[model samples]
Each structure stands twice: as C-alpha cells, then as structure tokens.
Target chain A: MNFLEEVILKEGQALSDQVLKVDSFLNHQIDPQVMQKVGQEFARLYRSEGITKVLTIESSGIAPSVMAGLELGVPVVFARKRKSLTQNGDLLTAKVYSFTKEEENEISVSKKWLKAGEKVLVIDDFLAHGEAALGLANLVEEAGAEVAGFGIVIEKSFQSGREKLLKKGYRVESLARVASLSNGSITFTRNGQEAWSL
Target chain B: MNFLEEVILKEGQALSDQVLKVDSFLNHQIDPQVMQKVGQEFARLYRSEGITKVLTIESSGIAPSVMAGLELGVPVVFARKRKSLTQNGDLLTAKVYSFTKEEENEISVSKKWLKAGEKVLVIDDFLAHGEAALGLANLVEEAGAEVAGFGIVIEKSFQSGREKLLKKGYRVESLARVASLSNGSITFTRNGQEAWSL
Candidate 1:
C-alpha cells in the first residue's frame, strides 16, 4: 500500500477537483512489477476466503485482476461493456450507470464462465462512485455466486463508494484510500487498523 | 503452445463461420495458470529482443499483456477505446474499425506514459482482421516507439489478419492458429517450420 501510495503521489496527475489521472502506472500504462506486488498483497489479504474467481469490468481492471488471478491460482472473468460478434446470448447481464460517462450501459458475462456456486472476489483500478463494483456484484449474484470481498487499487474515500458498499455489508479492501483531495493535494488514509485513526 | 491448443479445442466455441469464442479461458474468464504459461512463453520467445514495454488495447488484450509483462519484467500500456472523464488531453490517438461491433472507435494512450524510443511488444487475445493491432501499432509509432513484435493468443488463419500484418513486415507469433473451422472441427497449424508452411 505504501508503494502504491508513493506511485500515485509521484505519477498520478490531477485534472480538476474530482479526477486523478494515473495513466502512468495504474490504469492506462501499467507497471508490471508494482502490479505483481499489488496482486500478491491482495492474494495475501484475501487468500483465506476461498476465492474461486476474480471478477472485474473491462479495460482498466484486467491487469490487476490477471495479476491477482495468477497469485490466487484462480480464473479471472471480466464483464464486457460492448457486445461483440463473438459474444453469445448465454450471458448474465447487469445495467451499470456510470456517473462519469453519464450513461447507463449494460455489462455482461457469459453464464458458462461463471459457475452457479463459486466464491468471487471483485477487483478494479479505481473505486470512485462504486457503480462499477455494484454492477459487478450484481452479475456475481445473478450467477448465484458468493461475494467473498472486493479489492481495489485506488479509492476515493471522500466519495460515497465505500459507504454504499459497506451499507450492503460487503467487506472492501483498497490499497490506497484518498481521504481527501482538497486544493490539488492528496491525503491518503493510513492503511490497516490505523484507518480508524483517520 | 500445446496447452493453449488443447484449451482452444476443448473450450473454444465456434460462433459462426469466422468467429471462434474462447471466452471460457482466454478472454472473458481466464485460467491464471494457463495465462502464466502464456506469459512465460511470450517472454521466452521475445526475451532476446530487448522489449522495453508490452503494448495492447483493452479490454481483452489486457490479460495477455499483463501476463507477458510479468514474464518480461516490463511495463504494460493499454490503449483505451473511449475518452473517460478521468483521462487527460495528453494522448496519442488513432482510429480503429471493429468488425465485430460494426463500428469505428478511437483508441487513445496517454502521452506521459509512453516515451520515445521504447521497444514495445504488442499482445492481444485474438487476431482476426488486424485492425486493433494496426491501431495499436499506429499509436506506438505515433509515440516514436519501435514495435519489437506482436504476440497473439489465437489467430484465425482463414482471416486476412496475419497477411495484413505480414504485409506491414511485423514478426507475429500466435500460440494457436486455426487453419479452418468447419462443422465445429478446428485445425491447428503445425509448430516450428511448418507454421510458416501455410
């Protein structure tokens, strides 16, 4: 978490009051070594829950999910936003409302990919409004699977995402939680039990 | 390669005359162990080529790119299809035509993440019409970077993707190349010297 926080501080760019662009190492352009460490950290954190699959959305979440999947020796399944010709009709679909994109898009996963009673851990790059996570959780539940927990790389604690997921009684773990991004400065919540100190 | 071939034969579904769906393990739901082997194979194949970065386009390409990046110990940069609110204006953009979706979309990579003169190896899940690869290659070139090679999980030999890439003088390596898909039977091109025998 320290490494991730350091990387965010060093490479993440701020684009106004709400957006922090981590294209350098976290999302668009990825640092594999750092990603591997993050994966190992997630695996260490959630290894005891008996996670059967790692679920994520398309694009940004694929890298970390793949990394965590490798460490956990589980399969990684991603929900596709766009329906391609290769995609079949046998799918579990969920409608995700993106606050940023300002649109509601249907994301789906093949029912053949997710079993009926598997334990799934959801992973993603950023947890802002928690819409994507909730959507993914919906897909998992649609398959009659259990939500073991949620793992995120960077989280905006000031947002309602954490509160929303916690309201649903889902255990969420994030590597770096930004307590506040006031005046273009990032303040990360102290990880571990010290998170209570914030 | 044998493992990948076997996976394709077992789990891959023939959606139509041209589309082969391997979402069970290659794209939608990925087998981490097999993905690690794929990364290792890519690393072994391109280790001597001095690859500085792994380049790919999201969302399907992110898995194999991360795998290959883990093996090569290099960073992975994925081109995003749409401009998100989090993305900044500093980007290298290109137009890509999606045959499956039947649409044309713009893919972009942040300028801050990709540097000039980096040796990049492009990776993807499928090589059908080669538009995505060509779009990624265009982005790399726009960044003033050199493409070391292209690695694909599966390539439909019946399609013109390989020929188009070969015409561009790119060294392409596909783990499983389907010669033809007829009556739900798949034929793989022999490895080694016979691969080019086509």
Candidate 2:
C-alpha cells in the first residue's frame, strides 16, 4: 500500500461506517511530512493542467492547498466560511451543504483574487457528498475562471461525491479512496476495485 | 526591509487608523512563496527553543504553522474556532475576543493533541489586541504544556499585544511591526523604534 493508504489504515479512526476521523495527521493535528508528500502528489498529477490559482475552502483545506500552490509556484485562495471585518471587494459566493455539520454555509472568494480565464485547481480535505467541491467550482465559475480539476485528499467511494463530480465533467484525483468502513474496519479501493478487506 | 515588510508596504491597505488589510497576500488570498519564507523565518527564530509542537488557530494560522512544523519535523495543532461533528474527546478551550469582529469565539484544541510538559511555539497571522495570542497561551497552559514563545506574522505595534505578551514574560517576534496606520500610511517599527513614516 501507498504511504497515504497505510497512514489511513494505521492512524485514521473509524468512528462509524460514515465517519473516518483522520484528525491525527490530516486535519486537527497535522503531520507536515504527509502534507508535503500530498502536495508533491497533487503537483505531479496536475502539473500539465496549466493551473494558475489554487482554490479551497477555509480551515481544513488550507494546508494541502498551500503546499500544492508552493509546488506549482502559484497563489492559493481560500473561501471564507464567515465574512470577516476586513474582507472588502466584490465576492464570488456559493452555497455548500456540510454532511458532517448537517448545515448549509455560504462560502465566498474575493473576486479580486480570481481573474477571468484563469485555470483554477480546487482542493479540499474530504469528498463526502461533493457539496464543497461543487461550491468551490461555482465560485471559480462566478469569477469567469475555469476549473482545471480537483485534488482531494480522501474520497469516500461509498458516497456519490466522485460520481457527481465526474458526471459534471470534472477531473478528480483522490490520493486515498475508501471503499468501505464496515464492521469497524477500514477498506480502501484499489485499481477502481475492492482490495484488502480488513 | 524584509520581504514581508515590502509586501505589506506595497500591497497592504490601511482601511483606517486602526485596521491594516493584508487580505491580498497574508490572510484571505495567500502567496505560497511568502508563506514558505515566513515558515523558514519562524523555524529559524525558534530553532533553539526545543519546540515539540507548533500551535496556532485554525484557518489563517494553518499554513505558516504547518510550514514551520515541516521545517522543525514536528506536529502542528490548530485550535478550532468552531466545533465540528467529528471532534470528540476531552477538549482544551479558551475564549478569544476579536477586536476587529467585536465578537468572542471559543477556540478549542483536542486534549489528545497536546501533552503535558511539551514545548509549544504559538503562531498566529496577526497580533493586535493580544486577545488571540492570550487565548492560545491559555490553551497551552490548560493542556499542561510550556509555551516556548510566539511567532507573529504582522503586529500592530501601536497596540498593546506585544507589551501584554511581554509583560506576561512571553517572548514575541513579529516579522512586520506596523508603528502606525494613521493618514492611510503604513509606518513600521525598526529595532523597537518607530521608523519609515510615510
């Protein structure tokens, strides 16, 4: 297994079948080495996409997105979940429903940061229901920019996030794909097929 | 002037006598190269402190903290500004009041991420009223850890943040220290003395 897949199996906690908490390395408590590798992997995959800017939602998505931006020598723009006091400019916004929070939040990007005709790569930590990626893509479209593709850290194959994005004609690259988290065990999808079932 | 100071002078907007908007690079939209340098600078500043972990608030603080963590070969823990569904465990929380937003937010770090007696370097994007830094320090103390020092990207030197932290015996290193933003001009502090009045 790849390092990411191995990390998931070893460090990731399966709270339930629907929830895989990777707070130890991916989100809450971050391992910078893993983030660097994730950045390199994303850069390698999307190197030829002519990406001009990297777009992501705030908080969890910032690290990986910034690493990829550094690798690509580009700027990274994060959509704010809440409007701050100093946020001044025309804003590009979209509504995103969070499966985890079970709520809808309006995510926004400053229009000044995203220019027309720019090729943007959308990045996020998880792909559970596709709402965030769709929202971020909507922001890029609102700015008259094109979404080159998406780089997701972890994709839940049991969910329809990937299928939905694929149906919308978006290229997606997920470093680790989980087929199932049944019986308190983590099983990853390999070669688009079911692999070692723990 | 350093790269960060140059960027602030060229790109930062002084909204009023009290607010300096650096959303163009530091906070909202981020420059990866600048962030990389900021990380390197922080790592260099705190190299001798024996920092076992890098702690910061979520969203804006994640990038620089992760970069420093990568340089230091340690884990970076970001306190959540808002709670999420999967955040389960004993939590170490502190209430932080935002002078800009004029609201109070309870930032929380998982008890599991922080261990007693670990040396933590507190990093943040800005130091204004010292509320956020104080809140983060409170978290470190609550977790039974020792705070090595603070690494601030930008500091409003006219304000009381540095003085307050210093009075509490906490070491602070601000990369760009703005002496004043009066008359829509950015003036910086050099060697603890006011300099470059524009």
User: By lDDT, who's the top model here?
Assistant: 2
lDDT of 2 by residue, B21-84 (tens): 9987878899988888889989988999999999999889999999999999999999988533
Interface RMSD of each: 1.1, 0.7
Strongest candidate by TM-score: 2
Clashing pairs in 1: none
Candidate 2 chain A least-lDDT 10 residues: A189-198
**Model 1 docking tier (incorrect/acceptable/medium/high):** medium
lDDT of 1: 0.84
Q: Judged by DockQ, which candidate is best?
A: 2
TM-score of chain B of each: 0.92, 0.93
For residue A4, give model 1's deviation from the true position in Å. Answer: 1.6
Q: What tens digits encode model 1's per-residue C-alpha lDDT throughout A1-198?
A: 477888888987667568888887777788888888888888888999999999988878877888899999899999888533244568888878888878888889889878778999999898999998998999999999989989998999878898899999999998889887778887788645542111
In candidate 1, stretches whose alpha carbon ends up further than 4 angstroms from where it belongs are A82-89, A191-198, B82-89, B191-198
Q: Could you give candidate 2's per-residue lDDT for residues A1-198 as a string of tens digits?
A: 777898899999888999999999988999999998898888888999899999998888999999999999899999988533244468887888887877788889888899899999999999988999999999999889999999999999899999999999999988889989888899988765532222
